[model samples]
Target: MPTLTRRIRRTAATAVAVAVAAGSALTLTGTAPAHAHTGPRAATSSTVTSAQLTAGLYQSAYSERNRVLWATSAVGRPPVTRSSLLKVDPGTLQVQAAYTPPVTDAATGAVEAVYGIAVDDEHNTVWTTNTRNDTVAVYSQRDGRHLATLPGVAHAREIVVDERRNLAWASSFGDGTVVAFDTRTYKEKKRVTVAGTQPAGLALNERTGTVYAADLGGDRIVEVSPYAKEPRLIPTGDGPISVALSADGRTAYTADQAAGALSVVDLRKGAVTRTVPTGAGALSVAADRRSGNVLVANRAAGHVTVVDPRKGAVVETLATGANPNHVTIVRGTAFVMDKSAVGPERQDQAHRIRVGR
Candidate 1:
C-alpha cells in the first residue's frame, strides 16, 4: 500500500462548479437503440450458444441506451492519450461514441488525471475522479459536454453514489480519508478517516445506506454506516483492489489483486465466508446482479473469471485483452477496461459477458 501523502498540491485559486447536462436519452439516435440495456432480458431465454452467451453477457438492456466504457492511459510512458470514453452498443458490440478527454497543460492550468469514473444514471451525468486536479469532473453522458469541475475534492480516487441519500463518496488515497458530498450540489458534508495505508474502491448499498470500502494496504474492508456513529473494519484477503455488492445488498465481493483470489464477504456476518481462486492479478470485480455471479478482471492473466457466489467457486473463465483493469456492471453488460501499452496510447477494448444462472 502506498503511503497517504500530499502528492498533488493545488495551485489554482479559481472555484468552479460544473453541472453535467442531463440530455435526452439517446436511445433512438444511432443505429443502435436509444436506451441502455442491462443484465439478462426476457428475449434471451433459449439455451444460448457460446457466441450468444458471450454476446448476451455484453448486450445492452435499453437497446435504447448504450454503455460507455472509459480507459485511462496514464500507465503509458509520456502519458499516452488513453483517457477515452467509448460508448458501446450491447446489441451489436459496436462502438457508438468515442469521447476523449481534452488535453491540457498541467504546468499552467487545471487538468484531470482520472482514476475512476461513475455514471449518475438518474441525472444522466458522468462523474470522474480527477486525481491531478483534485476535483470531480461532471459531464453530460449524452453529449460529452463539461458540466462543472467540482472544486474542493482532495485526492479523489474511487467514488460511489448513494442514491437514497443523494450523496457521493470519494476515497482519498492521499489522506486515508473518505469524504461525502451532496450529489445535488457537490458540497462536502463529512469526512471520515480509515485505518489503512491506502483505500482502493468503494461501494454504497442504497438499500441499506451502508458504505463498504476496500482498503488496499490495510488488508481489510472498512464498513461505514451513515446512520451509525462509528465505522468497522473487517479483515479480508490480501490487497483488495476493487469491490462490488449484490443487488439485494446481502453479498459483497472483493478482488484481491495480490492474493490472486476473490473474497466473498457475507454482509450480514461482516466476515469473509469464501475465497475462490481466480487468475493472477485480480484487479477488478463486478456483480452480475440478475444472475448472482461475480465477475473478476485479472490484469496479469488477461482473462475474466465468473464465480458462483453461493458455492464460492469459479464457474467459468473468459479470455480478454492484455492487462484488463477496471470493470463496471450496468444492466446486462460488463464493460471491461483493457489497458494495453501500444505506442503513445494504450489500447483499451471493451468486452461483454452474458450472465445467466
Candidate 2:
C-alpha cells in the first residue's frame, strides 16, 4: 500500500481542474429507517463521476446542504513533510481548491503530519490534527486560508470541534487521554483520562455535548460527558478503532479494527446491543448521522460494507482500491482513501463509491 502522503501528492494538481467543473452533491446509500440508511447503490449505475485523484488523505464536509470534500497531500517521507489541502465537490467528485496550511516553522515550511481533518460549520473553520507536532492547525473553510496553529496538544490523533461551544476534543494516542481545547483561544481546557487504553478515533454528538472516543489499545469504546465533572466508561466492542454517532444521539457505532466486526452501543443503556461481521481489516469506519448507516472500509478486502445499525446486518458492499484506509460519508457519496490500489505511475486513481436513494 502507498503511504497516505504519497497518495495525496500524486493527486494534488488534478484536483483543482476537477473542482472547477464540480456540481451537485455525491449520493451514497439512501437513508435507512428513521435511524438507518440503505446500502450504496447498484455497482453499474449512472451516478458515476470523474474523480480528481490525489495521494494523501481526504475528509468530507457537509456544508450548505451540499457535501464538499477537503483533501490534503503530504510531500517527502516519514518524520516530516509539506502538505496542501484541496476542496472537492461530492457531486462531481472533483477538486475545487488546493490549499496550504500555516507555515509555522520557516525552517520546516509544512505540517509535521496531518492525520485527521475536520470542519466547524458554525465558525466556518477547518481544523487538522498535526500528529507529528502535537498541535491542531485551523484554516478558513470558505477559502482554504490558514488561520492559526494551536500547539501543546498531547498526541492528538483524531479531532472533532463543536462550534456552538467553541471547543474541540482530540483523542490522544500518546497519552491515552482526551484533550479539550477552546477553539477561540486555541488553549487547553480539560484533559480527561478515559477508562480505555489507547484512544484512536473521535466523534461528538454536539446536540448532547457527548463525545465518543475509541480506545484501540483497551479494545473498547469510551463515552465522555462534556458537561459532566467526570466522564464515564461505557463498554464497547473489542479493538474498536473508529466511532460514529447517530444524529439523534441515541445510538453509536464502532469499527472493531482488530476483530473485523462492527459494534453498536446504545447511549441510553451504556451497553453494546449488537455485533456484526465485516470484511477483514476494517481500518476506518463512518456513519450518516441523518440516516444512521454504518459504513465500514475494509482495508484488506478492498471493499466497503454498509451496515444497517438497527439490525447489525451487512446490507451492501462496494469494491474499492487496495489498502483503503479512510472512509468519510457526506450528504450522498462516500470518499475513501485508497492508499495502495493506485499504481506507482497513476497514484491519483481512486474510485468514488456512490450510494444514493
Candidate 3:
C-alpha cells in the first residue's frame, strides 16, 4: 500500500474543476449537544470559491499580517525532489506567487520532500516540515527565501507555531514524538515523546500555551507539554489524521478519518464529548475563531461541513472542490486544501470560502 502522502499526492493528479458554492447557515432544532451535528445541510452563511493550484497540494498556513495564504505542494517519490510553495490571495482565490523550498540536504546534498507548513507573522517567517531529511526550514514570508534549516526531526508530518509561547512544534510520525523549538533563537528546546504515539497533525493555542497533537498511530490526541511532565493522551477514534483547537484552548476538534466523524474533544477533561458522523474520509478540521464554527473536510463526500455553535449542531454543508483534505480559517474566510481524486481530468485546487461575520 502506498503511504498516505503518496496516495494523496497521486490523487491530486486526476483532479477535476468544481463549482464553489456559498455556504448556507444551518439550524438544528433537535437537542443542543456539543456534537449534535448528526445530518448534513446547515444554515449556511458562507460563500465558497476555489482556484486551481500547483499540483501535489498538501497543507496550508495563513499570514494574517500579509492577508495571504501559504500552501505546500509535493511531487516525486521517496526522497521527494520537487515541491512548490504557493502564496495565494484569500479574497480572490488566486495564486499570487509560487516558490520551491530548498529540499536538498545541506550537508550531504540529498533529495528531500516537504510536508506541513506554518506562518509566524510575528517573526515574518514561514516554516515547512522537510519530511525526507527530518528537518524544518524557515523562509522569509515576503520573498519566500530560505533563511535557515533545522534538521533532525524524524518524519515530520505537521507543524504549528505559537508566537505567544515563542515556540514551534512539529509532529514526528516515525519516532512517535513532538519536537519543540525556540522560534526566536532557532534552537531545539525539547522533544516530547509519549508511548505508542505517532503524532500526525498539530494545533496550538498560544494564548494558553497549549498544543494538541493528533496521534494517528495511537488513535488519540496527545496534549504535549514542552514546559514539563508527560504528554496527556486523549483517546479518540480509529484514525485521527488532523486536529483543530478552539481559540480559547478549551475545546478541540478532529477529523477522525477511520471513524468517519468529526469528534469534539474537551481539552480541559481530555475526553471526547461528541462524535458527529461526517462521512468516510474526513481528513482535516479548522475552527472559525470569529463565529466559533468547526469546519470539517469530507474528502470522500466532496463537501465541507460547518459545525456551528448554534445548538452545537451541524448547520450547513458547503460544496467544495473534490477531496478537501485540509482547511484553515483567517478572519471570516476559510482556506481549504481541496483537491480532486485520481482521474483523467484533475482539478486539484486551493479553495477559499467566505463566511459572514
- Tens digit of lDDT per residue, candidate 2, span 120-217? 65566777887777887887877777777777667777888876677888877787788888877778887888543788888888777778888888
**Candidate with more favorable, higher TM-score: 1 or 3:** 3
lDDT of 1 by residue, 170-226 (tens): 777776777787767877788888654577788888777788888888888888887
**Candidate 1 C-alpha error for residue 181, in Å:** 1.7
User: What's the TM-score of each model vs. the native?
Assistant: 0.75, 0.80, 0.83
Candidate 1 lDDT at 293 equals: 80
lDDT per residue, candidate 3, 12-42, as tens digits?
A: 3332222232332211112221222234343
Error of 3 at 187 (Å): 1.5
lDDT of each: 0.62, 0.67, 0.74
**lDDT of prediction 3:** 0.74
Error of 1 at 182 (Å): 1.6
Could you report the Cα RMSD, in angstroms, for every candidate shown? 11.3, 8.6, 10.4
Order the candidates by TM-score, highest first: 3, 2, 1
Q: Pick the candidate with the highest lDDT.
A: 3
